[model samples]
Target: MPRWRSRTRAERRLAAEQQGHRGEALAGLLLQMKFYRLRARRFKTPVGEIDLIAEKRGAIIFVEVKSRGHQGSEAEALGAVNSARIVRAAQYWLARHPAESGKDMRFDVIFLAPGRWPRHLINAFSAS
Candidate 1:
């Protein structure tokens, strides 16, 4: 039985938001475990938003997180990511932190579905 089936539309939206926050927290932990230093969460710019920003080995990663109630949708999550928007946001972020400008940067996506292991796709897209 899907819990959402019992929720009203507003309740469902709230639940989804809460779930997304949980997913982002979990994703951050996972990235830390992988030796990525967390930089920011829910980073926003006039151009767009990035769910998480992390760095490892001179590479800055701009991540988009997608949470679902269903499993095995990592590939589908990729489809939900707006690479161009993220790139623009990353550019804005770097502009604010000039010291990071010379470092390598890439966009990534993290998929989190209940009761399933999170999937992280590194260097998922390029700024070009």
Candidate 2:
């Protein structure tokens, strides 16, 4: 392949990997929703996007999906998930929904990694 083509493919692969990780996280969340008898959907927002939104017995859930296959600690990456991004995304989410505006809500992060157990960290952070 030409150098340009190879570089394009690499970029596409990275995008695909990121998207795949999100899909895996959503799938895991679906399993959790099922286990808890909740209803869920993938969400898209203007400010910040959420991978999944689940509502169980009472509360609303907003989920962020992160890839967790780093060889070393992910202190840097986790830190990079700053409050501003969360706020932006959350604003996008909240602005789009009228009915859910008044409901109780929470944020969760589901980690996606190969050969590693799935980790669902509930209430990962309060809304910014």
Candidate 3:
């Protein structure tokens, strides 16, 4: 059996969390390379949590990062995102930061998979 198959549930959960952190870090680096300034990581509100918040050219972006171990799981990763929860979190974030209220807001997704370049989807979803 694979080593992962031998691990306990908590161990697997921890591993998954670490993988998610790495994915978010990679996504952050990609954003910075594209000249986006990172405003927050793992921003948590009463409603939900946003993985990353970046700003550029007067646009405030809320990003969700999804990492998968398998090559063909990227689409499944994207499909697993809770868009409504993310939207609610963004609303809470905006309410807390009134300064960002006037700027254009967008939702983006970064999908990461082993052996594949990170796929960035701009305006991937909407608050509407």
Candidate 4:
């Protein structure tokens, strides 16, 4: 169960919004690893949010996917992968999964563009 805050109708609405966010995160992550199988999602942490966590080639990858409503500039979509955010998310992900601390970890990003194929950036950036 993901960290969802919902107790009343209004809370339910917020939960819905959070759930939607989680879904988008999952979608972006899946788009990246669609060739592989889904392992898990909504990886938690005190630093930031990790949209999706999947394993491929025996490597545990932490993916931070950002999808924006199409913008005029192509760079706008790619800009979503900020270094600070990626580091925070990766920190959170690694902190939660100690077993994966020693495994090959990668930070990736997937940009969902309008009327265009999703752009997958593999090992696009590193926390170091």
Q: Which candidate would rank higher by TM-score, 1 or 4? A: 1
Number of the predicted model whose TM-score against the real structure is largest: 3
- Cα deviation in Å at residue 63, candidate 4? 1.4
Candidate lDDT values, in order: 0.89, 0.63, 0.94, 0.66
Q: Write the per-residue lDDT of candidate 3 for residues 1-128, one digit (tens) a residue.
A: 65555888999999999999999999999999999999999999988899999999999999999898888765687789999999999999999999889999999999998999999999998899
| Residues 68-115, model 2: lDDT tens digits | 555334455456456566656666666677777787888776665566
Task: Tell me the tens digit of each residue's lDDT in model 1 across 71-94.
Answer: 855777788788889888999999
Candidate 1 — which residues are off by over 4 angstroms?
A: 1-8
Clashing pairs for model 1 are none
Residue 116 local lDDT, model 4? 64
Looking at model 4, residue 17 earns an lDDT score of 66
Q: Among these predicted structures, which one has the highest lDDT?
A: 3
Residue pairs that clash (backbone atoms under 3 angstroms), model 2: 48-89
lDDT comparing candidate 2 with the true structure:
0.63
Using TM-score, rank the candidates from best to worst: 3, 1, 2, 4
Give the TM-score of each candidate. 0.88, 0.67, 0.93, 0.67
Please give the lDDT score at residue 7 for candidate 2: 55
lDDT of 3 at 47: 85
